[model samples]
Target: MAVDQGTFRRAVARFATGVCVVTSLEGRADHAMTVNSFTSVSLEPLLVLFCVEKEARFYDAVIDSGVWGVSILNPDQRPAASWLSNRGRPLVGQLDRIPHHRGPETGVALLDGAVATMECRTTAVHEAGDHDIVIGEVVGAAVPASGPADEAGALLWHRGAYSRI
Candidate 1:
Protein backbone atom coordinates (compact mmCIF):
# COMPACT_ATOMS: atom_id res chain seq x y z
CA MET A 1 0.00 0.00 0.00
CA ALA A 2 1.15 3.55 -0.69
CA VAL A 3 1.85 5.72 2.28
CA ASP A 4 0.00 9.00 2.57
CA GLN A 5 1.98 11.88 1.12
CA GLY A 6 1.61 14.20 4.08
CA THR A 7 2.55 11.54 6.60
CA PHE A 8 5.63 10.46 4.67
CA ARG A 9 6.67 14.02 4.04
CA ARG A 10 6.41 15.06 7.63
CA ALA A 11 8.01 11.92 8.92
CA VAL A 12 11.04 12.25 6.70
CA ALA A 13 11.30 15.97 7.16
CA ARG A 14 11.58 15.43 10.91
CA PHE A 15 15.11 14.16 10.40
CA ALA A 16 16.99 17.30 9.42
CA THR A 17 20.11 17.18 7.30
CA GLY A 18 22.81 19.52 6.11
CA VAL A 19 22.44 20.90 2.61
CA CYS A 20 25.04 20.67 -0.14
CA VAL A 21 25.46 21.53 -3.79
CA VAL A 22 26.97 18.72 -5.80
CA THR A 23 28.60 19.96 -8.98
CA SER A 24 30.33 18.59 -12.05
CA LEU A 25 31.56 19.82 -15.37
CA GLU A 26 29.74 18.90 -18.58
CA GLY A 27 32.12 19.88 -21.38
CA ARG A 28 32.47 23.66 -21.05
CA ALA A 29 29.34 24.02 -18.96
CA ASP A 30 29.06 23.64 -15.20
CA HIS A 31 26.06 22.07 -13.48
CA ALA A 32 25.13 22.00 -9.86
CA MET A 33 22.13 21.27 -7.63
CA THR A 34 21.09 21.49 -4.05
CA VAL A 35 21.18 18.20 -2.19
CA ASN A 36 20.27 17.49 1.42
CA SER A 37 20.76 13.77 1.05
CA PHE A 38 24.51 13.74 1.58
CA THR A 39 25.86 11.46 4.27
CA SER A 40 29.11 10.01 5.51
CA VAL A 41 29.39 6.28 5.03
CA SER A 42 32.98 5.58 6.12
CA LEU A 43 36.23 7.25 7.07
CA GLU A 44 38.89 4.60 6.95
CA PRO A 45 38.79 4.50 3.16
CA LEU A 46 37.39 8.02 2.87
CA LEU A 47 33.88 7.47 1.58
CA VAL A 48 30.68 9.46 1.33
CA LEU A 49 27.34 9.22 -0.46
CA PHE A 50 24.77 11.47 -2.04
CA CYS A 51 21.68 10.94 -4.14
CA VAL A 52 20.67 12.35 -7.49
CA GLU A 53 17.20 12.36 -8.94
CA LYS A 54 17.08 9.88 -11.80
CA GLU A 55 15.71 12.36 -14.29
CA ALA A 56 17.76 15.37 -13.33
CA ARG A 57 19.66 17.00 -16.17
CA PHE A 58 22.96 16.59 -14.36
CA TYR A 59 22.49 12.85 -13.88
CA ASP A 60 24.32 11.93 -17.06
CA ALA A 61 27.15 14.31 -16.30
CA VAL A 62 27.75 12.67 -12.95
CA ILE A 63 27.74 9.26 -14.62
CA ASP A 64 29.91 10.28 -17.55
CA SER A 65 32.45 12.33 -15.60
CA GLY A 66 32.76 9.76 -12.79
CA VAL A 67 33.79 12.57 -10.46
CA TRP A 68 31.88 15.14 -8.44
CA GLY A 69 32.54 17.95 -6.01
CA VAL A 70 30.28 18.36 -2.99
CA SER A 71 30.24 21.74 -1.28
CA ILE A 72 28.72 21.83 2.18
CA LEU A 73 26.87 25.11 2.12
CA ASN A 74 27.56 27.65 4.82
CA PRO A 75 24.61 29.65 6.13
CA ASP A 76 25.39 32.48 3.71
CA GLN A 77 25.10 30.28 0.65
CA ARG A 78 21.46 29.31 1.03
CA PRO A 79 20.39 31.60 -1.80
CA ALA A 80 22.82 29.97 -4.20
CA ALA A 81 21.51 26.51 -3.29
CA SER A 82 17.89 27.56 -3.84
CA TRP A 83 18.73 29.15 -7.17
CA LEU A 84 20.73 26.27 -8.61
CA SER A 85 18.04 23.79 -7.56
CA ASN A 86 15.75 25.41 -10.10
CA ARG A 87 16.31 23.52 -13.35
CA GLY A 88 15.76 25.08 -16.78
CA ARG A 89 16.32 28.58 -15.48
CA PRO A 90 18.72 29.81 -18.18
CA LEU A 91 22.06 29.27 -16.44
CA VAL A 92 24.20 30.59 -19.25
CA GLY A 93 24.64 34.07 -17.85
CA GLN A 94 24.37 33.34 -14.15
CA LEU A 95 27.72 31.67 -13.60
CA ASP A 96 29.42 34.91 -12.69
CA ARG A 97 26.97 35.56 -9.88
CA ILE A 98 28.30 32.59 -7.99
CA PRO A 99 31.61 32.95 -6.21
CA HIS A 100 33.48 29.74 -6.87
CA HIS A 101 36.84 28.11 -7.38
CA ARG A 102 37.33 25.33 -9.91
CA GLY A 103 38.36 21.89 -8.77
CA PRO A 104 41.75 20.89 -10.19
CA GLU A 105 40.64 17.34 -10.91
CA THR A 106 37.17 17.76 -12.41
CA GLY A 107 37.16 21.50 -13.07
CA VAL A 108 33.78 21.66 -11.34
CA ALA A 109 32.86 24.89 -9.67
CA LEU A 110 33.38 24.80 -5.90
CA LEU A 111 31.46 27.49 -4.09
CA ASP A 112 33.66 29.64 -1.92
CA GLY A 113 31.10 30.18 0.80
CA ALA A 114 31.05 26.55 1.80
CA VAL A 115 32.78 25.52 5.00
CA ALA A 116 34.21 22.44 3.34
CA THR A 117 34.48 20.76 -0.04
CA MET A 118 34.95 17.16 -1.03
CA GLU A 119 36.18 15.82 -4.34
CA CYS A 120 35.02 12.29 -4.90
CA ARG A 121 35.30 9.60 -7.51
CA THR A 122 32.31 7.40 -8.17
CA THR A 123 32.83 4.02 -6.55
CA ALA A 124 29.37 2.49 -6.81
CA VAL A 125 25.90 3.42 -7.82
CA HIS A 126 22.55 1.86 -6.95
CA GLU A 127 18.91 2.56 -7.58
CA ALA A 128 16.48 3.17 -4.79
CA GLY A 129 13.01 4.62 -5.05
CA ASP A 130 13.22 7.33 -7.75
CA HIS A 131 16.80 8.35 -7.09
CA ASP A 132 20.27 6.97 -7.72
CA ILE A 133 22.61 6.58 -4.79
CA VAL A 134 26.09 7.62 -5.92
CA ILE A 135 28.71 6.47 -3.50
CA GLY A 136 32.16 7.92 -3.88
CA GLU A 137 35.59 7.61 -2.40
CA VAL A 138 36.89 10.93 -1.25
CA VAL A 139 40.16 11.46 -2.99
CA GLY A 140 40.72 15.03 -1.93
CA ALA A 141 39.11 17.41 0.51
CA ALA A 142 39.70 20.86 1.96
CA VAL A 143 38.25 22.78 4.88
CA PRO A 144 39.62 26.26 4.33
CA ALA A 145 37.04 27.86 6.59
CA SER A 146 38.29 25.87 9.55
CA GLY A 147 41.99 26.51 8.83
CA PRO A 148 44.66 23.88 8.25
CA ALA A 149 44.37 22.47 11.77
CA ASP A 150 40.78 23.31 12.71
CA GLU A 151 37.88 20.89 12.26
CA ALA A 152 34.96 22.90 13.52
CA GLY A 153 32.54 25.35 11.98
CA ALA A 154 28.94 26.62 12.05
CA LEU A 155 26.58 24.06 10.54
CA LEU A 156 23.71 25.34 8.47
CA TRP A 157 20.66 22.98 8.38
CA HIS A 158 19.13 21.65 11.56
CA ARG A 159 15.36 21.13 11.41
CA GLY A 160 14.15 23.13 8.38
CA ALA A 161 15.74 26.57 8.65
CA TYR A 162 19.43 27.39 9.01
CA SER A 163 20.85 26.84 12.45
CA ARG A 164 24.34 27.20 13.94
CA ILE A 165 25.70 24.54 16.23
Candidate 2:
Protein backbone atom coordinates (compact mmCIF):
# COMPACT_ATOMS: atom_id res chain seq x y z
CA MET A 1 0.00 0.00 0.00
CA ALA A 2 1.18 3.48 -0.89
CA VAL A 3 0.69 6.31 1.57
CA ASP A 4 0.08 9.83 0.30
CA GLN A 5 2.84 12.22 1.20
CA GLY A 6 0.56 14.82 2.74
CA THR A 7 -1.31 12.24 4.80
CA PHE A 8 1.87 10.62 6.05
CA ARG A 9 3.37 13.97 6.98
CA ARG A 10 0.28 15.07 8.86
CA ALA A 11 0.10 11.75 10.67
CA VAL A 12 3.68 12.02 11.79
CA ALA A 13 3.18 15.61 12.83
CA ARG A 14 0.51 14.42 15.22
CA PHE A 15 3.16 12.24 16.84
CA ALA A 16 5.14 15.08 18.38
CA THR A 17 8.71 14.60 19.53
CA GLY A 18 11.06 16.52 21.76
CA VAL A 19 12.45 19.64 20.11
CA CYS A 20 16.19 20.31 19.98
CA VAL A 21 18.82 22.42 18.28
CA VAL A 22 21.60 20.27 16.89
CA THR A 23 24.83 22.22 16.51
CA SER A 24 28.39 21.84 15.25
CA LEU A 25 31.33 23.97 14.22
CA GLU A 26 31.95 25.14 10.68
CA GLY A 27 35.41 26.47 11.37
CA ARG A 28 35.06 29.71 13.40
CA ALA A 29 31.46 29.76 12.19
CA ASP A 30 28.76 27.71 13.91
CA HIS A 31 25.74 25.97 12.43
CA ALA A 32 22.44 25.35 14.21
CA MET A 33 19.25 23.67 13.07
CA THR A 34 16.01 22.91 14.85
CA VAL A 35 15.08 19.25 14.90
CA ASN A 36 12.30 17.13 16.43
CA SER A 37 13.48 13.83 15.08
CA PHE A 38 15.56 13.05 18.13
CA THR A 39 15.28 9.85 20.19
CA SER A 40 17.33 7.84 22.66
CA VAL A 41 18.42 4.60 21.11
CA SER A 42 20.21 2.91 24.00
CA LEU A 43 21.14 3.29 27.65
CA GLU A 44 23.99 0.85 28.26
CA PRO A 45 26.46 2.64 26.05
CA LEU A 46 24.29 5.80 25.95
CA LEU A 47 23.14 6.38 22.39
CA VAL A 48 20.87 8.86 20.60
CA LEU A 49 19.60 9.40 17.08
CA PHE A 50 18.24 12.21 14.91
CA CYS A 51 17.34 12.43 11.26
CA VAL A 52 18.70 15.13 8.98
CA GLU A 53 17.65 15.97 5.51
CA LYS A 54 20.21 14.72 3.05
CA GLU A 55 20.22 18.10 1.36
CA ALA A 56 20.58 20.23 4.50
CA ARG A 57 23.69 22.41 4.45
CA PHE A 58 24.69 21.05 7.85
CA TYR A 59 24.06 17.45 6.88
CA ASP A 60 27.69 16.90 6.02
CA ALA A 61 28.77 18.92 9.04
CA VAL A 62 26.98 16.39 11.23
CA ILE A 63 28.16 13.35 9.33
CA ASP A 64 31.80 14.18 8.70
CA SER A 65 32.28 16.04 11.95
CA GLY A 66 33.62 14.04 14.87
CA VAL A 67 31.36 15.61 17.47
CA TRP A 68 28.06 17.46 17.89
CA GLY A 69 25.65 18.65 20.58
CA VAL A 70 21.91 18.35 20.96
CA SER A 71 20.39 21.15 23.02
CA ILE A 72 16.95 20.04 24.07
CA LEU A 73 14.72 23.08 23.85
CA ASN A 74 12.73 24.20 26.85
CA PRO A 75 9.01 24.81 26.50
CA ASP A 76 9.70 28.52 26.05
CA GLN A 77 12.22 27.83 23.29
CA ARG A 78 9.69 26.95 20.60
CA PRO A 79 10.25 30.31 18.94
CA ALA A 80 13.98 29.76 18.74
CA ALA A 81 13.42 26.30 17.40
CA SER A 82 11.09 27.66 14.73
CA TRP A 83 13.62 30.25 13.69
CA LEU A 84 16.49 27.80 13.51
CA SER A 85 14.36 25.41 11.46
CA ASN A 86 13.62 28.04 8.88
CA ARG A 87 15.64 27.45 5.76
CA GLY A 88 14.40 30.73 4.33
CA ARG A 89 16.11 32.70 7.08
CA PRO A 90 19.86 32.92 7.60
CA LEU A 91 20.97 31.40 10.94
CA VAL A 92 24.59 32.53 11.23
CA GLY A 93 23.86 36.11 12.29
CA GLN A 94 21.22 35.26 14.85
CA LEU A 95 23.56 32.81 16.61
CA ASP A 96 25.68 35.62 17.99
CA ARG A 97 22.63 37.32 19.48
CA ILE A 98 21.84 34.30 21.64
CA PRO A 99 24.11 33.45 24.54
CA HIS A 100 25.56 29.98 23.99
CA HIS A 101 27.93 27.63 25.77
CA ARG A 102 30.24 25.08 24.24
CA GLY A 103 29.98 21.48 25.33
CA PRO A 104 33.14 20.00 26.87
CA GLU A 105 32.92 17.01 24.56
CA THR A 106 32.10 18.52 21.16
CA GLY A 107 32.83 22.24 21.44
CA VAL A 108 29.37 22.68 19.89
CA ALA A 109 27.05 25.41 21.07
CA LEU A 110 24.52 24.36 23.67
CA LEU A 111 21.60 26.76 23.67
CA ASP A 112 21.61 28.81 26.85
CA GLY A 113 18.87 27.62 29.24
CA ALA A 114 18.07 24.59 27.15
CA VAL A 115 16.01 22.01 28.98
CA ALA A 116 18.74 19.39 28.54
CA THR A 117 22.02 18.92 26.76
CA MET A 118 23.46 15.85 25.06
CA GLU A 119 26.92 15.82 23.52
CA CYS A 120 27.66 12.99 21.14
CA ARG A 121 30.13 11.51 18.72
CA THR A 122 28.89 10.36 15.34
CA THR A 123 28.63 6.57 15.42
CA ALA A 124 26.67 5.58 12.32
CA VAL A 125 24.62 7.12 9.53
CA HIS A 126 21.98 5.11 7.72
CA GLU A 127 20.04 6.19 4.64
CA ALA A 128 16.31 6.47 5.12
CA GLY A 129 13.64 8.22 3.07
CA ASP A 130 14.67 11.79 2.25
CA HIS A 131 16.71 11.89 5.46
CA ASP A 132 19.67 10.19 7.03
CA ILE A 133 19.35 8.72 10.53
CA VAL A 134 22.53 9.65 12.39
CA ILE A 135 23.29 7.87 15.63
CA GLY A 136 25.65 9.27 18.22
CA GLU A 137 27.37 7.82 21.24
CA VAL A 138 26.66 10.07 24.19
CA VAL A 139 29.87 11.69 25.38
CA GLY A 140 28.62 14.36 27.75
CA ALA A 141 25.13 15.20 29.01
CA ALA A 142 23.43 17.70 31.36
CA VAL A 143 20.14 18.83 32.77
CA PRO A 144 18.79 22.14 31.51
CA ALA A 145 19.27 25.22 33.62
CA SER A 146 16.63 25.18 36.39
CA GLY A 147 15.14 22.10 34.76
CA PRO A 148 12.76 19.99 36.79
CA ALA A 149 13.82 16.76 38.42
CA ASP A 150 11.33 14.88 36.27
CA GLU A 151 12.48 16.97 33.31
CA ALA A 152 9.25 18.03 31.63
CA GLY A 153 9.08 20.15 28.47
CA ALA A 154 6.96 20.88 25.40
CA LEU A 155 7.00 18.99 22.13
CA LEU A 156 7.13 20.73 18.73
CA TRP A 157 6.64 19.97 15.05
CA HIS A 158 6.50 21.40 11.54
CA ARG A 159 2.69 21.51 11.70
CA GLY A 160 0.79 21.45 14.99
CA ALA A 161 1.87 21.81 18.64
CA TYR A 162 1.35 19.69 21.73
CA SER A 163 2.19 19.70 25.41
CA ARG A 164 4.29 17.03 27.05
CA ILE A 165 2.54 14.46 29.18
Best by TM-score: 2
lDDT digits (tens) for residues 59-113 of candidate 1? 9989888889999877667788778877886756445788999877767788886
- Cα deviation at 117, candidate 2, in Å, is 0.2
In order, the Cα lDDT scores of the candidates are 0.81, 0.80
**TM-score (C-alpha) between model 1 and the true structure:** 0.86
For model 2, residues 1-165, the per-residue Cα lDDT tens digits are 899989988888777577889997867668888888899999988999999999998797777776789988767676778778878677567577666899887788988878778899989999998899999999999974554522655545545663543
Question: Over 4 Å off in model 1, which ranges?
Answer: 91-94, 145-164
Quote the lDDT for 51 in model 1.
93
